[model samples]
Target: MQIKPKFGVDQLLFGMKQTDVKSIYGNPNKQFKDEDQNVIYVYNQQKMRLTFYEDEDFRLGYIIASDPELTLFNNTILGRKATEVQKELEQHSFKTWEKEDFDLAENHFNEDHWLILQSEYDQIVKVEIGAIIKNQDEFDWKFGAK
Candidate 1:
């Protein structure tokens, strides 16, 4: 999986309509509703979960990726040391944040790119990327363009 920061992930982009996504990936292998009642498309082969916000016309909004081959700025981040991940992201013009998200795991977030990494025992375990919606009417969005 290639993380495009606040921009998007791989070929899937923020503000993309559900129809577009379905056309590209076909129907999700599995579908479920989140607590907010938003629809999530799960791709088992990709080890990826894509979230489409209902209020945003079911456009792409969030992504949860567990692939260890996750890449960003040409760097494979997952399964790497936290220190190494931080350095890689920083070298690519990302801001750094190292903290714990609710005590579940250590978190490294890049506000500049809207990316979050969850780590256990100092190794990144998951990669989260979400978009920033500026205007729903225009579908103007970028992952971290706040």
Candidate 2:
């Protein structure tokens, strides 16, 4: 899987409805409404969890993946040390992360870019991302355009 911040991942673009994704990935292993009332689809075999928008549109807004081959900026990201990943993001000029330190998990989020990395055992374990939605209807691609 690929992480294209402020855009889409692979063929799955933000603003795509659940049905749009179903056409590509087929039936999910599990599906449910999240606490925030957004629809969620989990594909266990693919190690992915997709979350849609909360409002009526139900566009694809967020993605969480644990796939070992997941790459960001052409670099394989998962399983690397957190510092290494941070450096890579910095190299891309993505600074200003909202970092949270905890006993088990260290979280970093660049809200402006809507990219998140979570680390356990000092190693990056998961990548979560969302498009910069504008007017609740479109993916703001300006960030990636830079």
Q: Across residues 9-91, which tens digit of lDDT does each residue of candidate 2 receive?
A: 76787778888889989999999998889999998877899998777468788889899989998999888987788887887
Against the true structure, candidate 2 reaches a TM-score of: 0.87
Candidate 1: the clashing residue pairs are: 6-143, 131-143
Off by over 4 Å in 1: 101-104, 133-146
Considering every candidate listed, which one attains the maximal TM-score? 2
**What lDDT score belongs to each candidate, Candidate 1 first?**
0.78, 0.82
Candidate 2 — what's its lDDT? 0.82
The residue-level lDDT of candidate 2 at 88 comes to 75
TM-score of each: 0.85, 0.87
* Each candidate structure's count of clashing pairs: 2, 0
